[model samples]
Target: MGTADTFIKNRLDERKASGIYRMLKPENSLVDFCSNDYLGFARSAMLKNNIVAEMAHYPDSLNGSTGSRLLSGNLKYAEELEQQIAIFHEAEAGLLFNSGYDANVGLFSSLPQKGHAIICDELIHASIIDGARLSHANRYTFRHNDLESLEGKLKQAKGNCYVVIESVYSMDGDTPPILGILQLTERYNANLIVDEAHAVGLYPAGLISELGLQNRIFARIVTFGKALGCHGAVVLGSNLLREYLINFARSFVYTTAASFHQLASVKMAYELLKEVDDEANVLRNYIFLFKQKLNNNSQYKLLPSDSAIQCIVVNSNGNAKHVSGQLQAAGLDVRAILSPTVATGTERIRICMHSFNTLEQVKLLTSTLNTITHAQ
Candidate 1:
């Protein structure tokens, strides 16, 4: 092999030996327990039909955006959809990005300037961390969900301090005390940016809006891929902030705009979200059932969360992988979150409960988990 190939193979071999190698698996027919489709909109026949119908309204639309937004790809319909979404979420304005990763990366990287501060929760998403890394700002991370820790970081911040956090943490599936965090940010005069990727469809317009804090937050990132079951994301803030990102955020400025059909899907998803309060309730019920099955059982260590994303810590790479494998073998779809995605001893099987998951399915998942973890 060539020298580069040798180096690549050695690095991959190290990952394999360390039990952290990754591979993409084909879709299977197992019971759903490991997807971000909290509201089942991704799998909804109604949603599919609505999107198809909506696309029919724009018969001459392009199959794909010809170029980036600044080039030949900007569409009037895209901006209209952005306004509709922003208004629905009670924001002054909004700007769309291709996906949640793009939104977070674009917002975090471009907003904070040199000598400014970007303070994030230690458990913030990898995209945010990467975005912060690309910025010229001084970066710091507080202990996850710790108000005191965040306050300490805020005090150390310099110019144009921005505090970043997720409304629903992906791995832990828990929410920070948002009000407390917001109060601290206000006191410190820091800009609070919340990523509501996992909380969007489940909470009407997301946690900030649900709490009537839409006008209070500096900026909010709402993703469509998770509960909304669509393909893009939007950053909601002031009209000035939207304009700033359009000019300064490289991810949004350089990437091709989303296609007509993708935009149609997003629009359709939001309409469906308005009608799915019942489904949202069903999702909450399933979450409760899953937690009840565990019942603080000493055998399984389930993290505390009210969100659809639930984690059961198994404490090692080997244990987490084995438990996840056993779960998949039992006709349940579950995946392991191994280090260094999480800390070494905090590796877990991340269980995602959806509105369409039946009661029997939840029972089987918890029972199977009990059996496997007890066997350990």
Candidate 2:
């Protein structure tokens, strides 16, 4: 084989040696504590029916968009979905992207010019980091969620500056101090971008809307895959920004638009978010009880979070993987967040709470976890 292939295989071997090799498992019928389908809309019959009905209206809506959006893939439903998202999020406009990763890479790689700078949180998502790496701007990382470090970096920026962060950290299950970060962004006259992938459907509203910071941020990226229980993502911004991305964002321009069925499901998920109070409340209560149980256990420590994600820090990757495997054997479906995915010293087992998960299931899994750790 090629030398490049050999180099990649050697790297894989090194990862295996460090106990951080990764693999995907087939879907199991076990109780789920690992999926991002927080609202359980992914499997909803009502959503399925809505998508079917919408597709019937456009008989040609099927399999794929023929080509890139700039060519033939731009469908009427794509524009309709963008309008719905902008109205729901109270933004001037919204632009649809195939996924959150595409949206981040396109925005970060294209927006900031050569002399400008990007100051981002160290713990931001990998897609954001990859986008920044491809950018022409000089990039620097501030301490995770530390506004003081961000401000220090802001003072050193030579040109137009952008401060990037996430509303909720994926690995740590914690939120940043947004108000303080906004204050610094304003003081330094820098644009602010918040990736709300994990917070979109779970929060009372989105972080920007709930905190009344929508006007302050230059852009916000929201995904449908998490709480919305669908595919695709949108970038909410001013009309001028929307126009800019339409012309300049390569990811949006080159990719075929999402199909009509996907757009219809996204719309239905938002409708459910407004109407389904009981289901949402049940999930919230389970989260509260789960946290209380973890607090009572001396061996396990839960991170500080009011969102749907929770993490139990198990410092070693091998140990975290071992605990997760035991939980799976006992019929729970929790996932281990391995090193390299998370920082080496902070490897964890990520438990995603869902609206469909029962109280007994939560208690059983946590108790099983307690038993496993205490046994060691």
Candidate 3:
């Protein structure tokens, strides 16, 4: 075999030995407990119909965005949709990116410069970490959700400090004390950037808008894939920030824009979110039900989270996989998140609660989890 092929095989073997090798599995007909469709919009027939209707307003012949926005891809509909979304979120302006990863990588990689500092929560998403690594800014990580640690990092920051965090942490499913962090960042005159991917539809517009902090934030990244059940993301801020990213963010400037249908999906999703705000409440109640059911059972260590994403620590990759397998065998779709997706000893089963999930389903899931965990 070639040298490069042999090296790849060796690496794959190493990953297999560590119990952290990865593989893609097809979707199953198991009970729904492993998706990010918090409001069930992804599976909603109504939502699909709305998207189809909205797409009718655009050119029927258009199959794709011909090029990047700066090229032939720029369309009036796209710009108008951005404005509508920004208005809903109470932001002065917004710029769309092809995906949440693109939005994060573009924003972080371009916004901060040399002699500047980029500080993030230790538990920030991988995309943000990658973006920060690509930038020239000096980078530091505060302890997860620790304002004091964040303050210390800010104090040592040299120039143009930017603090990054997720409104809802993706893995642990917990949230930081955003108000406290905002106040601290204000004190240090640092720009606060929030990625509200997991919190968008679960909280009206997002947690920032729900708290009336839209005017105070320097930038907010809202994704459509999770709660909104759509396919792109937008970075909302002042017009100047939008313009800067339009010109400087390589991810936005270099890639082909999302197609007309994709953009229509985003637009229709937002409209559906407005009409079905009660879905969030139903999802939250399910979250409570699951927690209450498992509360008295001490077999599994449930992570503290008020968000749609719920997690239970299994401590080791093997144990997590085994527990997830047990749940799956019972026709539950719960999956194990092994390291290095999370830390080595912090492998877990990440459960996602959705509005469409029934009370009986929640009960069965909790009971099944308890049984499986007790056996472990």
Candidate 4:
């Protein structure tokens, strides 16, 4: 009907030509190596039962959040849950968001003043990148996990500065040198924000708590959908930050408050995390096993990470897809991380290990992968 239609179609065609086009497929019934259900809570019937038990405790809780938190959507006991979350994480206060993306959008979109600066790692999540893009502050991206590069950018920062990074990067699964970066940010008089999306339940209290550096940094973003096995996220900071975001963060101000069911699910998930405190160690065992098996394979160039997400670079989108397809055919549901998502040369087959995954399953997955590499 218009030039806009033709332009949009051309962009779609370009994606196809570039070997980066994507579409959602039905959930694979293969082995459990592709999901973010790091602890198998998504597949746990006990969690669902716990949700029902939790809902029973809140008779007055509504079927749906009627409006934004500013209006009718504020449910009884919601603030109590927020406080519980804060206490659990050893933070002064907590504010909930519908999802990690919404939280990032709200936080960065609102925080940076006109003369302030937001410096983020280049490989930080797209949500943070989008949020920084929306801000009026001078934004800069340092090389991923390169503290020296971060300092270089910080040297040119104008006003109040915020340094953003993930505790555990989602793509490569490697953790940044958090203490070193924290020292750098402190030296520069900058606030540090850590996205603990993948490291929430993986550490003792968190990476911060495990490092014995609680309340030293500015804020920690914790998401429940991954390790906690539920939906929603929270910003852990001071009460003043909570009040400020409630007032100014557009995503929080304009969106409907999280439903009681979602909030209760978060609560119950934490209860499960505490009840099964040894699960993190169990996950570490799998990571160790996978790495140990891949040892001495001179041709295998898997990324160095101590986390559940293990990536093997395939160099090209075509090759990554082909290898992933071979694995999937062997009954593993691994996925390929393509270019545009990652750099062209760093395209990979991302194998996500879970706590519930069996030792035999891990063995089979590695064996299949090793077979593929040998064929290549």
lDDT tens digits by residue: candidate 2, 120-156: 9999999899888888999989999988899889999
Task: Compare candidates 2 and 4 on lDDT and give the better one.
Answer: 4
Give the better candidate number (3 or 4) by TM-score: 3
Candidate with the larger lDDT of 3 and 4: 3
Candidate 1 clash total? 0
Question: What is the TM-score of candidate 1?
Answer: 0.98
What are the C-alpha RMSDs, in order, of all predicted structures? 1.1, 1.6, 1.1, 1.4
Model 1 global lDDT (CA atoms, 0 to 1): 0.92
Each prediction's TM-score against the native?
A: 0.98, 0.96, 0.98, 0.97
How accurate locally, in lDDT, is each candidate? 0.92, 0.85, 0.91, 0.89
Better of 2 and 3 by TM-score: 3
> Model 3 over residues 305-334: C-alpha lDDT tens digits?
999999999888888989899988988899
Model 3 bad stretches (over 4 Å): 374-376
Q: Find the 10 residues in a row with the least total lDDT in model 2.
A: 293-302
Q: Pick out the ten consecutive residues of candidate 1 with the lowest summed lDDT.
A: 367-376
In candidate 4, position 68 carries an lDDT of: 97
Candidate 2: segments with Cα more than 4 A from true spot: 295-298, 374-376
Q: lDDT tens string, model 4, 203-231?
A: 74578877877678899999988988889
* TM-score of predicted structure 4: 0.97
Candidate 1 Cα misplacement greater than 4 A, ranges: 374-376
lDDT of 4 at 58: 74
